[model samples]
Target: MQSTDVTQRFLFDNADARGQLVSLELAYREVLAKHDYPEPIRALLGEMLAASVLLSTAIKFDGLLILQARSSGPLSTLMVECSSDQELRGIARYADDITGDDLTDLMPDGVLAITIDPDDGQRYQGIVPLEGGTLAGALEGYFANSEQLPTQFRLVADGRVARGFMLQSLPPDRQTDPEQRAATWEHLSILANTLSAEELISLDNQTVLRRLYHEEDIRLFDSGPVIFKCSCSAERSGNAIVSLGREDALALLDERGGEVAVDCQFCNASYRFDRDALEELFEAAEERARGLH
Candidate 1:
């Protein structure tokens, strides 16, 4: 059976290339369930989710990777996040009358920002102009500008499932000849371009490889699970409230009838804080500050 909610890595044993395949079902549905997004928005968000997982696994890091896009078109914002552990959550904001099907139509003049925040090191971010009218195109531009690696991506989402295929040329350590390296990358990219959206979303990883690279030496890796998990909690909500200062926090509580409601946009999880909770939250924050001093 075709695997769902899983990501797998594959490598070309005979070429200086590697790739990743991601198929998401449950995680995609979970993210869509949080809000009543339009069909186009749903499809775009789904693609972003799949792309995030593909890029996350492609890199070596012990932190979070965020793909955020902003524009002046109907689709104002698109954000997808994936952690090193494969946990995923995403959300999109669009005008109610949104009817665009492609990135250019939906997010004209948009810019995509890719951020990698390592657990023990400095965070890094790269901004790429949203070119080629698709998420995959924008990402290819990012790799070309930042890593200077030849990369290509095929992404598809029908609101039911989201699937992605990424192929990148690794450093030419084994193949020192520049001409051969270019030829190899071109051959692999051409074959990968033949892959259809239907096949990518429907076939298993092994089948995908066999169908795409039947003439090449391919090395397939084990698959890993991808899940929808929002990193929101009462503690985090309380911290946000405390960050607003005790006076404003209490004022907002009063304005909202003695309670402040904090809602997580990703998961639709709500956290409510009353007078007692707010008072105690600030008191504890104050105590921590004093201790630090």
Candidate 2:
């Protein structure tokens, strides 16, 4: 049975702990649809995508989880993002002659940056050193240092799918059952580590969960849909131009044959804005400002 890109949260009824089973099939392919990434880079994207989704389910925030990294070596930047809704997207920037062996080595001394942005409040971001450790290790370190939780995660991204599984102790204040938390998290992780890329990319959610935790009493919640969507459009891109001011906006139009092209790096979706498009967008802003005055 084939599984869709489904992220299911499970709560140990009496164990006082929580977990998530995430399997990405078509969703992973959607992310890699148009991008050409090396094997290692593809694997990294898978890890980050799953990590981002895990973070979304673990935390109670309503916003975005962005995983970004920059290296001083060959692979300049690698990024992946997942939202509270389980929507995921990511890409890797590499040179034409990059090899799998060279890709992991490329970020020997880079920095891993994770940003948590809420829709109704200020955004917070954390950065950690990427010292020879994999993306999962770096994020685990982030949780230890920031949230101080005993978190175990397995992130897998293959050519066909990217999925991640996570187990974490409930906050002491939330449950106040230390023994229960330990037993639950430990048992779930013991089984979770057995997951393979083939299983994650192909099996159905129910089948995958049964294979890992058939005997456990887990309450599966509503799965938020996950998809490959670009939040870019001509109106939004032109608003960016308006922020840059009318002079710069006209300059861009002249530079790009009377139309400005705004491309989203994640999905590679382009939004084109010509003179008239820019004029309307700028006019709306001006009118709003005038009304405020």
Candidate 3:
């Protein structure tokens, strides 16, 4: 059996290609436990969570990778974030009594946005129309249009387990031959296309790769854990309260029976602040401001 809640990277020694496999068990259950989402919402959120981790490993960033889907249909919003360290969290908002299974039926005019937020640099976002009726298909369009890379994604979820596989063509610095590159890419994609959702979700990483690329030279690396960890903290929440400014914050606190409450939508974690706590937060903020001057 495959290791639960981990991502493993692989490379093709014979071709300029690379891939990663992600399996989410405990982490996915943790996210689902936070919200009572509909069946479709749960499944889509699982896929998004798997996708975020897979994308995070492919990118060379030391921050967060966020995948968000928004629409006006039954499934209104879905968001998943994965950090460089493989911490994951996700949430979904949808209408009740949702019966639709296809993306077009659930999110008719939806848009998928992939945002890269680096720890010490500017942020970048790419938006793509939700096409091909599946998250995998829409992401393929995102790569085809925005990144111009030959990439393939296999994402599957059954509300209990979420798993994803990604195959991408590396830059042609070593291959340098267009025809050979195309041939190698086509070969890998053809083999990957033969992979069934059931097989990908059920098989172990070594078994899956052996079944698909038994004849190819591939290297599998050590796996890293993927966990469900909310980035929200009392300090961040305190900063948000301070962002409201002193007078308004105090007035809001007074209206809320001398205490203010904050609930994180992602993890359902609650943070509360009384008048004294609020005063201290603002004082610290002011002191920091004065020090900066």
Candidate 4:
């Protein structure tokens, strides 16, 4: 049976390569239900969500992996983040008349940014031009130009379900033959290229691997669950209000009829602050600042 909202890692025993397969069902639906997105934007958002999960698995950091597409076109920005624990959240900002299925049409002259923020270390970010017509192609270009690794990605999403498969070549081991390693990577990539969108979305991990690399020695690992989790909270919202300064917060509250409402873009959760709550928050912030001084 197929598992929904899970990511599976696999390795080739005979080649210096690794891959990740991801399928998102409930989590995808949860994100879409938060807002009404056009078909093109929804599909692009779904692909980015799936890509974030797949890319996160390859990183050894203990924080978050964020994928962002920014452009001046109809689709202004699409952001997706995946935590180390496999939690995911995403949002898309686009114009109302976003039409066309091509990435270039939606995000013309855009840039793709991949950021890795570790829990306790320096952050790293890479930017690549969105030259290709597809998100997968842009990602492949990122790897080629920045990481210099031979990578391939197959992403498919139909709003209800999002699926992704990633194949990357590992650096040749000291003991491995360089020519043979190259040959193995080339062969595996050729087979992976034959995968279709229908098979990736409908088939299980094991079945998909078998269909693609039935002749190769592949080791599939246990699957990990991916959940739709928002890292927003009342405390965080309060802190944001505090950053606005006490006077501005109070003025905004007064202008809004004594309540300031903040809505999270990722989950659409609303946090409202009235006079009393704002006063308490500002007082606490002042006390903390005093203590620091």
Query: What does each candidate score in C-alpha RMSD?
Result: 1.2, 2.8, 1.3, 1.5
What digit string (tens of lDDT, one per residue) describes model 3 on residues 1-293? 75589999999987899999999999999999998887877888999999999999988999999999999998899999999999999998888767698788999999999999999999999999999999999998999888889899999999999999999989986588999999889999999999999998899999999999999999999999999999999999999999999999999999999999989999999999999999999999999999999
Superposed by TM-score, candidate 2 places the C-alpha of residue 183 at a distance from the truth, in angstroms, of 5.8
TM-score of each: 0.97, 0.87, 0.97, 0.96
Q: Candidate 4 on 165-239: residue-level lDDT in tens?
A: 999998876318878888888889899999999999998899999999999888999999999998999999999
Instruction: Please identify model 2 stretches exceeding 4 Å from their true place.
Output: 1-3, 173-188, 194-203
Clashing pairs in 3: none
Q: Model 3, which residues run further than 4 Å from truth?
A: 1-3
lDDT of each: 0.92, 0.76, 0.93, 0.91
In terms of lDDT, model 3 sits at: 0.93
Best by lDDT: 3
Off by over 4 Å in 4: 1-3
Going through the candidates in order, what is the number of backbone clashes in each?
0, 0, 0, 0
| lDDT of model 2 at position 85 | 83
lDDT of 2 by residue, 184-225 (tens): 667777787788767866776668778887887778787766
What would the TM-score be for candidate 1 when compared with the true structure?
A: 0.97
